[model samples]
Target: MARTSIDYEDVYQALPGMVALLTPDLVFADVNEAYVRGTGRPRESLIGRYVFDVFPESVNAPDAKNSHHLRASLLRVLATGERDTMPLQRYDIESPEHSGDWQEHYWSPVNCPVLGPDGRIRLILHRVEEVTEFVRARGLGGDTAGRVLEAELYTRARELQELNTRLREAHAREREVALVLQKAMLPATRQMGHRRAAVRYRPAVGALNVCGDWYDLVDLVGGHRIGVSVGDVVGHGLEAAGVMGQLRSALSATSRVADGPGQALNVLGRYANVVDGAESATVVTTFIDFDRHVITYSSAGHPPPVLLHRDGRVEFLDRATDPPLDARPEPRPRPEASVAFSPGATLVLYTDGLIERRREDIDVGLRRLADSLSHHRELDPEPLADTVLRELLPPGGATDDTALVVVRL
Candidate 1:
């Protein structure tokens, strides 16, 4: 048999699938245009770099397992002279153009070894086919397959359904684990001194990601004062949840040493800036002094706490509005506002997620919350919290986590 020389590079680069040629030492020798586009990286950035260095896994979460499995598969292909096909894998990429923010990417990949003239493995061929859109389509499809071969269509459709079902199950499991973790971090219905207290936490519906919304009730000054707080970190997933946990712990520790909400929040803002990826957080902290019959509170860009008067009047503690924690390096003073509460009055502290809607302005949500509180003022603190959440979220539910703390004097 006679063989003719050809421009293999032209064919390789023209292939629709993303393809990369790597050296035996795992450095990228060449990457196709498709590969460059898929990675959102330039040829110069990838051609000389080690594969793992260019596409490192996320250490903070949501994509750590994806990085581990992909690395393992590539290593396997390098060791054994067989093609390794990986199932759909999530490999979030950090785009320099996007200020080094991580972006979601899903791929079905195969790695194979290319041989030299001596039959030694000299190069590795990495091929990746993006299946994110296809997976999403399968998840969004109706019952019918439109017009196609019934049997083959049925088989493929069933496979898509199975994949979708598996994804949903995995999401459910992840949500349950995150919820349990979040619950463990919070206090389990403890008495905040002599005040009647109740708390509610509801993660976003069908949300696989863990966000940073938390509430706490802690005793201050040997049970002479009660410290209550609600806080929300800026983003979602494990990193945000981790920050929330740290902030709660720090707040608990700081509140014990400080004299009032103003001093406590000032210290907390400095603490939040030091924690990794804790860009900003909103917090509402209140100290109820049972002996003095006064409640002093502070807001670090958090929504104001609603006060339901014993005579059915409603008011918002809209003072001491500072920027969110971690917003500034210079520690500015956080002001504390005080208001005396009657014996039957109620106080409500909540994250923005409780009242915020996707389409409407936040002020509209606030008005609705105020109205709801006015109507439900006669209810117990626990039932009042439930009523507020039900009225705001309805049966469909909200898109962000909701954390609420209610206290009755």
Candidate 2:
């Protein structure tokens, strides 16, 4: 067999379906040949204009609501980053042959978001199947009874569509509430003073932007010391987010008073035992003393932090590791370790979502993380954080929540 390369642009242009690409703000970016022919507009004319401006609702049919429904669907896709299938819509397009006239059209439309590497919506794909001929045929029979039956069916469909819209609105409201709660729990990252640092939190795609991952950076009592931690609770949605908040707060408070990272996590483990949905949670904490040039660290069955040297050497801080929170029936002291780093070295801490992949050995994921850090060791903390995420995350985005923290010594 011979191998052949495919030109995706050619395929997109040759697609039989009417398709158009629009910016997140609804300006047209590109249109397929079918779309140009279907709308009776030239490709050049349609490419740069706003979708509604190019296909305005007919003034003759004021009640048609052609633009209103389509705009609503596209906006929903933007808000949720999910595909939206709209019910059959009655739209009127300007007649190409007669400039002053409008022709009735019916369409089955779907709007979808094209996500970027960071999981944000970059573009909107709008595809529609013209159904004007089939809809007209439903009323073409001379029999009065046939036309009346078709009308009833169309009314029933419209009612169902309205019901679906209501349900979607309800879901959106619930997601909004959950998102607000999560944001309230996670504090914004503050300035790291002499040491530079960056933090990023990404929730799972299609999980309503709520998950169990969390990261915290706290300024210790002394000006030269700071505490940084990342953790993952065992579930998703409101329950996991609530547990994560509680655990993170508990750890933060313990770190402020405890003698070391081990003592802080031991206190957190005891608190986790009483909190529902906190069992088997994994967390890693590190307290950096800039004056001492030391990093004291402990992990509760979480992945080890990476220390990337300026010479492209990577070190995994895994000497002190213990089981997850509430894993042991009897409370015992957690282990802690300390490592020294030179100036310009970087410290990277993250949740499992940064490395783990479905059905793959964890060592491979760990190696991949180390390789990325070694290659990009020269970048500063902020760009290092962004670059690591861009390289480590799956193309469609992580299925689990990810929290990342990067600091330069």
How accurate locally, in lDDT, is each candidate? 0.80, 0.86
Which number leads on lDDT?
A: 2
| Candidate 1 local lDDT, 1-409, one digit each (tens) | 0012346678888999999988878899999999999988899999889888887766435524766777788789778888887665656677768766876566777899997635678998999987657645655221122122234446776999999999889878877887777767877766654557789887776654467888888888754788889998876766778888999999999999998999999999988888985676789899888778788999998889988898889889987778888777688889999998888899899998888765567799899998998998888878888888988875656768888888887
Give the alpha carbon lDDT tens digit for every residue of 1-409 in model 2.
0012356788999999899999987999999999999989899898888988888887766766768989999999998999997766766777888987877777778899998867899999999888777767866422342355447657977999999999899879879988898788877756777778888888887776777888898878765899999999987788888898899999999999889999999999999999998888999999999889899999999999998888888999999999999999998999999999898999999998888876678899999999998988888888888998999988878877888999888
lDDT, model 1, position 337? 96
Model 1 misplacement above 4 A = 1-173
lDDT of 1: 0.80
